[model samples]
Target: MVNVIIRSNEANAAATALTLAARDHHVCLLSDKVSPGLYQFSYFGEPRNEVLRAVDELKAGAPVIGVVFAEGEDVQAGMQDVLRVASPQLMVIVGGGITGAVEAAEAARRFGLDTSSVLQIGAFLFGGNLSSVRAEKHDVLAGFLGPETPDHLVELALATFPRLSLGNPAAVALSSINALFHVPPMLLNAMSVERAESIRFYVEGFGDSVCRLLLELDADRLRLGAALGLGLVPVQELKARYSGPDAPKGLSLREQVNTLSSQTAALPSSFHHRFLRHELRSSFAPMAALAAAVRVDVPTISSILRLSEILLEEDILDHAARPAQDFLNLMNTHSLSIN
Candidate 1:
């Protein structure tokens, strides 16, 4: 049996992995909170350096096959240090939020270490709410989306890993801001879930960059969604208005709706049907609107943010928004078209 160490600040991160490890292998979890068990380690959120030292001591007598870092920052630094000091048999698995996973994966690649990220996006999109949404090729499609690496590093961590149970800090921040666009006016007036899900399918179908941004901001996004429940403002008032060099002169929040509406007219009529008609009134649109608003400074996200509102009305900025474009370029698939 391979010995595995599951590490993270998020309670569920360790808990979820521990559950899986205990059921599958001779796995043990090291966490900041929770109880000791046949396969658990209780901790107080120790520093990365201290964690590294502990791993070193543990490896002296026994073989540690894999190290799974599930939460906190400085993940790249921590993983790298451990990789350098730990026994050569160690394989690292990073299962944190976007930044932590991205940074750790990149660092592992730099040192030529074996690693992968496990998000349940594919599973949830294809598996969850099956009765609510009809999809035929769900499992096959879900398993297809993987990391975007040219070096050919990513392999299946598992066919299905548990979904991220609690929101990570970065996810919380991104999601919070993305929720502003879905406020009252939009919800009470023109919301349409079908269209919103359609747009969501489109964007998430694109790839990692958009999805990473969404996951990193999930908590904040949901919080912003709750704000709309309070009935604070009109939906039209929540539209994003850009002020960058590409934006028309003197645009501000007050003039957001009118300016954005007029700009929508200039887009291809196909856009109105694919997005605007459907998303503009859905819960998803508002979320997309928030992403557009917060990322008003970034033209790509801004455009996607606006387009998402047009498509689903919700900010379905997760992996489905623009799957083919974002990580498709990096993936090794024949269907790498930027659709």
Candidate 2:
């Protein structure tokens, strides 16, 4: 029996399940074994049915684990529904940025979830999607957040990926390279975005200048972690950890971008894509708030949040209340472990 049943609306995160299901194959097709039309949410489309706009049912062991992987906004809005249906032994939010992870963890806390059993773990790994990044080429760095974590749960989580479990979920979230890789390209290449130009984002937009911006953003997150007494992973370090065997060590941000071109060749047609929408709120805004609470100013993060706010037409910080002191404390707690 499957120890946990992972669920997701995002193709990449949901692909985590597919990777597990098709463990032996380099590539797995849903149609190869299962009828997509019958089991999935054809109501939306195959891409989303994998996780979102619908769900799959199973009469497995009662009180099973449930994992949600989708856009942060969607996860934030639909977590209640997920809980009602899954009533899982464990609830894992797979793709929500640091903010979503914290928010979901708080919600679970408020609901009086027993961390020992019905635990909620907010985690996001860079490459869980086998479709986008092959298991061989892909890199995994999963960070988890929740109280009283059990070794069995950690093992169960590791069973889902082929990488080590990075400690302290908050540190993992703050160290996410997604925001560093995405926000800069969106703002710097706003013109191409406006034109809806079908150019490669990383290769074209991820120039030396953009890479510098990415480093600066990463620096802010690292600073926030430092202020909280946690030392987050540096971008180059994460890149090396997750990089394929052929990948070179000590790559600069630009070199890393070039190395990742194969995975990031698919670019969004508009700035209205998730890179801006998801990362800005999930990673940037939350980091900014934490930076404020810890008194570590993140001018770059702040500027991007503001720019995306104007572009997305919303005050991203308003999504969550004042940065919870506990938030900084959590980071502090993890920082101590890493220190």
Candidate number with greatest TM-score: 2
TM-scores for all candidates?
Answer: 0.34, 0.76
**Number of the top-ranking candidate, with lDDT as the measure:** 2
Writing each residue's lDDT as its tens digit, candidate 1 over 1-339 gives 234454444434444444344335444444455333433232222111111123423434544544444233255555554455454344443422223334444555677764333221211111111011111111111111223422221222332232222222222222222233322222222333433433222222223333334333333444443433221222222122112233344544334333432222222223334223332222233344444433422333344456555545454455333321222232223232221
Q: Kindly state the number of residue pairs that clash in model 1.
A: 49
Instruction: Output the lDDT of residue 20, model 2.
Output: 40
In model 2, the worst 10-residue window by lDDT is: 24-33
Regions of model 1 farther than 4 Å from truth: 32-72, 81-101, 114-329, 332-335
Alpha carbon deviation, residue 6, candidate 2 (Å) = 3.5
RMSD of each: 18.6, 6.0
Candidate 1 yields a Cα-based lDDT of: 0.33
**Per-prediction tally of clashes:** 49, 4
